[model samples]
Target: MSMAQWVETYGQGTVLAAGGVLIGLSFGFWAQRSRFCLRAAVIEFWHRRFGEKLSVWLLAFASAVIGVQLMVLMGWLDTGSARQISAKGSISGALIGGMLFGVGMVMTRGCASRLLVLSANGNLRALLSGLIFAVTAQAALGGALSPLRTHISSWWTVEGGAPRDLLAIAGVDHWAGLAMGGLWLAAALFFALRSPQRSVWMWLGGMGTGLSVAAAWGFSQWVAAESFDPVQIQGLTFSGPSAEWLMRVMHWPAPPIGFDFGLMPGVFVGSLIGALVGRDWKLEGFSDGYSMRRYIGGAILMGFGSMLAGGCAVGAGVTGGAIFALTAWLSLVGMWVGAGLTDRWLDGGAADKPTSLPAEGFKRP
Candidate 1:
């Protein structure tokens, strides 16, 4: 059946929510299996150890870039109307917010998406941190912290369109973007082959995770085209979704069921299934008061930073980067730099050593 027919039968909200669930489920399953965390990759990069973590992240990122660019080249995709490209963006917000998020992820030992995935795998520490992160994200979105975010965002703003489109700014086309993705994929393959920790999941899961991002874009665009109702063309993102979920629980008049509405729950259930199948599910908590404080602090930073930056790691870093969004690239670079510096400062000489988590699968090498 056609998407329009499906929407007509099931309603636009239902169709969109179902699409979100499917996309989120795939993303969560692949991410959990691959243990794809930007925090681990950044740590490995800074420590000068190109290991499995770094390779997995590179593979996912390169795949997303390739997938998105390929669709654009084939005339099957249009990102021109996407908010990341069409909306006014902030340089100051991307830099500062990205750095803050990077620092927070290092402190928490996981990025926003990683935390959610781990939480689903029965990690109490992750569950708590995820809750705190959601709360803070809500606060930043429209709560007390909104003013600060607005102030920071206003420091330096760029008009949408050509200014935000990295491909346009570079004077290149989608083919150039696709070629860049190819180079990154080659580098990812080289690293993956050499890594001693290579495994089946690393290859399959990394690629799957990236492909999921592209699927989200395609699915949303298709739905928007077919549905008579105005539907947003969005990909995977956690910050706004988290905040939306939090509000749903606390306030009345629930928001309309959309992609974000189903995404969080879908990811949770998908991660749970992945964990059970992989026998990686485990309950864990803070070992000490200091550790608890660290997690909470990190959560707060991540929540606020993700909102300020307009996206979390996976949202802006991979999804937006694939579309060659200028702000997304800047935010990604800031994340890397901030993560590296924070790791060096916080861990010192032990930065190269793997920090074993309470759970077995989450260990950073």
Candidate 2:
């Protein structure tokens, strides 16, 4: 059956769910296998080692940018329809939220994607972190904290008008924008090769992650175009979808689940598969109450910050920025600065030492 006909018969939600599952599952598998962690990427850059890990992340972002632009060139996607693409941005929100999310990521020992992967590996601590992360995100987004969040986000919004990208700032056209995005991706590959010791597996994993994000855009666009009920054009993102999945679970008459909704569970399942294949599956937990306290605090901050900044590290920094949104870049800088400060604090004023990622970041035996 045709995509449009299939949507009519099985429901657009179903098609989207299926697409989300495939995308999320593949991404989760590669992420685990590659040990792709953005926090570690930043730390590597900070210490000036510029290792393979950071290169993987940059390559992923570049791949995503190239992929999305390819679809755009083909007229298969209109990236402007995505929520992350906007004429205005919350400058204060991006800075504050990015910093808070960064600190929270350090405390919880993982970003949104890493949390999903860890939970799949049977890390009970990650399970708790995921729960707190989801519930708090829901609260900040549409629950009790909505009023405060709305107030803060609206307090100092900046309106750039039309396009809302770096290309616009430079007064460039669509073709120039595409060229620039391509250059960014090429630059990422060049840097990846510069790393003294990057495994082929790491390179593949990073590229795979980018492909997932790019594929998500194509899938979303295809469905929206084919279906009578148009869906939002988007790529991979966890912060908002994490909350959406939670609400769907708690509600009796759940609202229609979007394509992105299926991604989290797919990631979980994919991570499980990766662990089983890699022989790294293991069950673990926190050492003490202090750690629990730290996790809760971190989750709360991450929830608030992600909502305010409009995304998490992967959501805002990689996926969104690759699509050419201006806020993504700002949020990324904020995350870098924030994570750096937290790393310094954890290092006990030994600011010169390289920051260490949490144990959860590793695929332990």
Candidate 3:
């Protein structure tokens, strides 16, 4: 093909990749600045009775809903681009997966994405979790459990032959869905605002979390629609991509790096750079072999759970929320419940404990 033709043919992947880079950078920066971790959110909420972290998470959800809804309304994206919303899947799997993921995150002291960023910051424990998460996720995606995932997903169906998203469940149009989602967002904001530490940074953190997912979705749609001469299209989420990258290195004939793959690496790299730039990079390890064991176990559960659930907090929680996917909501609730239970269990039935923020900070070299 001529140069012009080549540009026309290859431009989509390029644009999509660019968008992914933006999304990754934005999320890494925002997350680092805001200290937004779902495990931390739940822990702080229960222990300190502080809602800042929770509020940040809620804001992200609301922002994602609004951004994606607006994109759909503006014809920038088809709502179907969201996989968790449009794809057929088992609610039971999502719940089970989410619960497992939640418990694992608590045991590991971080979720999949959190582990990735933390590993980048030089947390050896997190590095171990990231490694296990990647392997288990791959196994679940196309390994021994793949059949189970497929079988269960195939058997489950929603009412009215509707899409598995929240809007469909409510029997509402896109606009109505957006409005309802916005209301939830508003409630999150209201609750956040009630916090004594209210500030612009907190609001931004919440909105950024949600917006990051919307951007990833839009970017995915753009890439998937684009025709690339030698490349494929993809979107965000940490679990599968991590494993895929490893597989690609070991086995040739792997698909070309796409938006999702690029974004995942970008988040890891971006966070590392951010930590270094902020002079926050440090190398750390587990306190003991027991801590190491718990971390690895947590990572394995998180990996398997994220695979079965169809995404991690960012993937299913924020991105799925943007599309109002019922499974996503279920997964989020399951994660929270699992996390709460894990925390309590860890504490030996002690219902009351002070919130434990990472004392060493999450920066790594």
Q: Give the number of the best model, judged by TM-score.
A: 1
- Superposed by TM-score, candidate 3 places the C-alpha of residue 62 at a distance from the truth, in angstroms, of 1.3
Alpha carbon deviation, residue 196, candidate 2 (Å): 4.6
- What is the lDDT ranking, best to worst? 1, 2, 3
- Candidate 1, residues 1-365, lDDT tens digits: the string is 98899999999889989988988999999999999989888877887888898899999999999999988888778988899999999999999999999988888888889999999998888889889999999999999999999999999999999999999999999999999999999999999999999999999999999999999899898898899888779888898999999999999998888989888988888899899989999888778898789889989999999988889999999999999998998889889988889878876745545454332255543
lDDT of 1 at 353: 53
lDDT of 3: 0.72
lDDT of each: 0.89, 0.80, 0.72
Ranking by TM-score: 1, 2, 3
Error of 1 at 24 (Å): 1.0
Q: Which residue runs does candidate 1 get wrong by more than 4 Å?
A: 354-360
Model 1, residue pairs in steric clash: none
The C-alpha stretches of model 2 lying farther than 4 A from their native spots are 86-88, 160-163, 194-197, 348-358, 363-365
For model 3, residues 240-261, the per-residue Cα lDDT tens digits are 6788877887688986655655
Checking candidate 2 for backbone clashes, the offending pairs are none
User: Can you give the lDDT of residue 217 in candidate 3?
Assistant: 71
